[model samples]
Target: MTTPARLSAPAVATPVPWPDDSVSVLRNRPVRLGTDPASLSRFGDDDWNIRPAHRDAHTTICNLNLRVFPEPLRRQFRAVLLAALDHPQPVEPGGRQRSAEYIGIGSMPVLARGLQLFAHWMHLQGVRQIADITDHDLDVYLQHITGTTTPLRQQANTLNSVRTLWLFRDVLPASCRLAAQFPWPGRTANELVGLRTSNGENKRPRIQDDTMEALLAWSLHMVEEIGPDIRDAWQEYTLLCRGEHSSQAIYVGTAGPRLRAYVDQCRRTCTPLPGIPGPDGPRINYGHVLRLIGLDGKGAFSPAQKRWLAGQGLPVAEHSTVGVITGQIQGRPWRDTPLAIGELSGLWRRLAGALFTVVCYLSGMRPGEVLSLRRGCCDTDEATGQLVMHGHRGKGYDRAPDTPDAAEPTRPWVVVGVVHEAIALLESLHDQPHLFPAQLRVGMFRPSATHARTCSSVNRDIADFAAWVNQTFRRADGSAPIPDDPAGNLNASRFRRTLARFIVRRPRGLIAAALQYGHVDTKVTLNYAGAPDTEWLQDVAVEKLELVLEQISDDAQRLAAGEHVSGPSADEYRRRVVGSADFPGRTVISPRSAERLLGSTDPQVHHGEGMTCVWRPETAACRAARLAQGLPEPAGPDERECRSTCTNLAFTDRDITRRKQDLHDLKATASDPLAPRPLRDRAAAQAERIASLVHRHEQHRNEGAPA
Candidate 1:
């Protein structure tokens, strides 16, 4: 059970010159290093600010701090990381060059973090230099990371970080390079760590229907009702602060009379002096009073004046109670108490969060894309009157010389009117170029150093907003406005998935219908998948194919239970379902295989309003209409053109039950004496045909039953 001694690395004939000082691997050039001179020194500094000079305002600056690594291994680790940045590794063994680009600056921090973890492990194993590490040591390290509680994806990343040592061995200085090839060669990090590769499925959990409904409802209430008041209060507070900081000469000239009139008016109207919460009791808010009177300094009010104001018999309260509360909840005032000056900032944050929810959920924009939106990004199309959001795609870009920034090409998202309202509110909330800035305000309009709110920050905002809604508002039955989602906290990414699910489930729903006929031309494709700019189309296609397979499986189960199916295509339905009964539910299927399974002839079941369509193009009644419209032959029945006597119709027991209900409704209408004569005759004819269908279904069911 003895551990083997580490072996020395092989010597190199021509050693690469390791620089004692050089520009950081992150920066392409040190053009605007700002006040930090250490940014230019590669080996001298531990903290490297990896923020690119041309970075988008929405993207947060990244830092790679080597301070966490042990001092002895720092140089060696730095060499490996710099080599990774300087060189391009093959996409695969002997594969074509990957976009002929170096690793992106954004990915450097994550890579550095993984390397730092490996350095610590190496230190623990008494292997100081990468060259001293042996294959056996790497094998043990792999096992160590695998055994940890870290997720499989992270473990794979850590392993890939170690592989970099060997990947760039030729470029590294002889002493810093791994002599032996990385262990587990020919196997990917995913395979080694047992991380399953994605099968184009969107595993992001959709927010439950009730939860989404409640969340959207409360968000709409905040935007439509409470938002204006919050905005007005913020504007007033900002102006008061601005006026307080005005020049002394101007304030002195206007202060004397204004102060006298303000005190006199407060006393006359019996209005309370604005104050903040105090330990002893409510005390006069001197700052607020000074700002209100247009005074410049804290000592603007004298002792005699303060005493005179205190003895005026005016009430003191945390906030001005004189303003009208316009927002309501459950037919009562939304707030029984006035909004405190201190609470204004929290209200502003909540308001922004609500806006974010509305825009993100309604537009199906990624969190980053939403954050990248600028003040004037949204506009109404003049031709169609459709709201279109013009923003850059934050993903799916090749890290090339021409486009080095985070944003991709400008893309348009067809949004609803409410999305435009949210964007307008955001534009008014902050003066920053980004619609969702990191800082809303700090007494005055000032953009944050980071400029934009990160996705992680927006996530917190949304979660806090939900909690705030539940705490502040209640339903008629006394329940939280937004129920807790079992999928955990609702995030930006989940919104897209939830939206896709809803679009698929209810294509005729308000949002879906609007998107369908909007300028975006998002019909079955986008409704079943995702927006044009997103990768959701493929994910949705996979989901749809899986759904079809699931339906076939369900049909098999029903048939196994001896359920009767009748119609022209009933035998066809049984044959297809029985043939595909062995189809696996969650197993990985290639795109080609999925396409074939979803082909017109395979598992030919299409559920319609009152029947199951086992489509055969020649027998389909909807085929002629599609051809007349110059459209391609349909893969399934067009439910809009479905005919009662269509030969491809297959009626299950469920459809029969629906038909029975339809027949009852028709009979009632046909026998109505108050109905017009022609309408009654039409209803009577339809009822007779429906009755015949129902009778035939019952006869078929009885004949199929075991005797």
Candidate 2:
């Protein structure tokens, strides 16, 4: 194609006065999910209902509850399905009823609800079927899963609606031909929800207030009669009963076990769920005990361990001179364990430190993003100003590297100021050699689940300090709390999550934050900052790209671990830090959207902006209907495999000459130091991206489009 010549400009048109509201909103609003209408034929692109034309929207709602609580739902769902194999609905009715058995109200109501939902969803799909069931029937089905509209629950209107819709989407199969076989987790949740419907009352035994008071008083009397350490455990158990923030008591792991044993004894004497009697008087399962200790398994609850805590009770607290708390109580709220500096700083530090957490939290930068930071990325003018941690090692320059392509990875950790203090502290603590150089420490340890080499040690130090603070400064009640450990909760990965959380809550300072990330929408920024990937998956093809942030951080170590050819050396991390690229166009693009729009790079065909193709005039199809003109098939799929397919069309000498000349000109022009920075930058970007794609194809074997 000849380059179009630029000629004369048109005269300026008269300017019109602008409207008061100059910001015209774009047509990019996200599709919100709900269960107002279900499709019979297939879901359509209706905002409130399922969309038939858009598979993304259809699948968006499908298997979601699956993602929420996968295993339990699957187990419960499968059982219902097997039992209802014979139940049938009109298979041909508006293409509804993947099957009627899914709706059976037998022992399982949730599964029935899911079936009803699937049918409704089918109706929403576009097959306007004559009613098999009336709207009253649908309401009956809705009541099955979420407990009947108690006023307390009614207030959660959105949640109730979602709960209702979750059931509807439950029947859509993960990859089923017959919709009945769909693998939605809603099947399982519905089953668990099944428990309440069948019983019509709280089945599990709960300790009443008077009884709890007696138990606490007894425990305190026993502890005061016994030892100091046991007394502390008794006190903690009492606090649990009172619902105090005695989560602090978990620092002593033994406390949970002690209190659990005490509670278990009391449980044996109470009334149990109907039919399932207490072991002696009342038997508690492992689920209940774990809850006391703050450990939640997926959907199922038990006291933990195989059997209940036997008939025995915990001995009265006995005083120990050492005053040490250990075991169960010391190890509670394990989820909070190894408190991520990112989390601690974010929650406790006025949400300011969260800004730092966001940066390192997304980018996974080295400590330098926070500690060794400079103001370059965010501020062009302020050279030595506050650093934004916007570090991305762009693609290879000049000739492309021959190594395997590494896919475009998103930032998992990007931090800002958690280390600002640490940096200043390090300046006081150690002589400058890449200050607070946690990377230097990473080389010493083998990768252990107990401790992440880079991120953990820093956090460990911070936790120590935090713990120390709490211990040093006792409460008015003379209790020692955390932040007293002397090892502060500040560290290497502190930069990312703190910054991300900060950005999420306070996006107003984004331009300032953008000095680190640049101004992207807060939603995308949250994902970059490592928010869970619940939303944005079933979006338009254009927005899918943002998924990279989740992928990268979700398994930074796993990704890095699998990638490491040998033990991850220090330099390897540094490379990831510098070589990473903050995905561009994040405000409008999401991970799923990006993947659909940009197919993976393959050298087999020209891709990206440099693609070229030629149409063949001799093809019969091309010549067809010249007023019923003869036509030929467009060659065949074999030519698409990359052959001389273009030969079907006559090639003029000038075309060949120009192509050869153009290739030469492109090669020379590609080397210009004086070329427009963007073109040169784009070219470099393209080459790097090509390498990333190739590497991805090698690693994953199934690299889809860019998203």
Candidate 3:
């Protein structure tokens, strides 16, 4: 069998040309600092598109890189730096002015700020190479980039390391080639703008009690001057405050960077966080900025983190409290009176302006979640008419782990009866649809399915609102302590803590009633679905029905209970109703494994549980077996035989045992292709894939390469 000679190959079909230097540089496609080929390939061609809204996968990627970075920095670098690198380009640098979707000024600011910071780093490294660079040029350039004034430290607080590193990567890639006659000749290290930890007072934006007081006083006067209603003007003003207006604030950076600065300033009083040093540079250490996550040395308060500490009795957090009690209300703390905020221009315009404070104190809903409420999400239950808070996420979103997703991701959230009253009161007055609604006009119609709200925004709205409320309302009793303005001011997050305190300190007789605090306690635990309340009985019943098919074993108990017990369809139970009438619901009971096997083998097993066993006298298998075994077979013509007396073969314990074991073996085999053995071949395949990835990563590492 000689095969015809294969056609001669034409001189190795012209070898493909390698990428040219210019094209290579252009197509460099900067890799995420720790991107691995295996991961890249796993994503196939969508390497840059795998932007998970949450940080888990990215955290995993960064955690893998933790070996390179220190524990303190691993998370921040990954969260900020790696994220910036992950997305190489912006969809739009500033924002789409004509976007009908109204993508908010808030939504784009952080990105702008992040990009600017990254650019700053690159600019620092390339400053020497750029033509005619001087301090004046640098100041103008930096203000242009960061949106701060001549003294970078004086204007406002900035995200230090994260901003710097991001600026470093992003700015250089685009502008390095466009330096026009000037060349960025410095080494890679010099090109990166580094941060030094400054203990200086100006570097940190101080949101002191006095500042808050002044702002409140300023707000009140502005509101009074507006006279009655400035609904149209107020709406625009709020939009401007959110940096949504075409008219931008006078700041060092662009309109976006200015908003970012606002966020930074606001966060100082909302979600106070410890400052991390810039990548490869000294950290801007402001002892004044308090940290929510405490410091190691004496656990000194990070002046930055003081906002959350407002109600926490922290000395540093007292500043905000003083302003809350004095400036906004001018009413004594002991009086159960609310000073009108109507006079204050923008004060009444904010959704969280006042009502949220009372709600947080009484009901215990998280300020952020409460603020984020929409009109229709709150409903009075049809059965009990209890106020139910519904959303993907809002307040009271704590568990023990500090997740970036906390209170940010919208998920199913419930507000208890306490929140109900306040919500009702607010609804009766205001008609905004979005809860914790933003002043930015462009972002309210819909939500981004891709990302969650930022922690800073969530915190800021809450803190500012809390301050207004505390100042607006006064306690009747002189014993009630006034909020300290310098340190403590109302913040959205303080609601959770205040809630916990309330539950613990509830009046002696009202302990049980405290469960009404959103019903998260025993009502909505993992062990149960929904609340124990009767309203959820139907849902629970259906869930239990599924579990019975998966986990239950008692057949007589199941049958006598009168459930259909053996059927292919769940809809059968829907036809004839039986469970608890108090709880009208659906039940799902499917054919048992043994019944399925028996039915398949001998089609006569068509009976639901609790039904009388059918005797197929025409061709009884037991009678036939008895006849075959030398016992007298029933003479059906004359009609009587003792063969029917054998109860052992008719639904006996031994038979059931044998049948159950058979079903177990059958199910076990079906569950695993490699049956009779515990571990399946599929597990081995998964192990091999993971091992391959590890090996590939190791190969790169052995050669001193980046991940």
Best by lDDT: 1
Give per-residue CA lDDT, model 3, range 424-535, as digits (tens): 5445433445433443234532222222233355455445654554465435664222345454554545444334333422322112222222243443431112332222
Per-residue lDDT of candidate 2, residues 478-580 (tens digit): 7653322123334433233333434322322211222222333333444223343322222211221223343324324443444321111223322332233
Candidate 2 segments exceeding 4 Å error: 1-380, 383-421, 438-453, 475-502, 506-707
lDDT of 1: 0.69
**Ordered list by TM-score, greatest first:** 1, 3, 2
Q: Going through the candidates in order, what is the number of backbone clashes in each? A: 0, 159, 84
Clashing residue pairs found in predicted model 1: none
After superposition, which runs of candidate 3 have C-alpha atoms over 4 Å from their true positions?
A: 1-352, 361-363, 382-385, 394-418, 435-487, 509-519, 524-707
lDDT of each: 0.69, 0.31, 0.34
> What's the CA RMSD for each of the models?
6.3, 30.3, 29.0
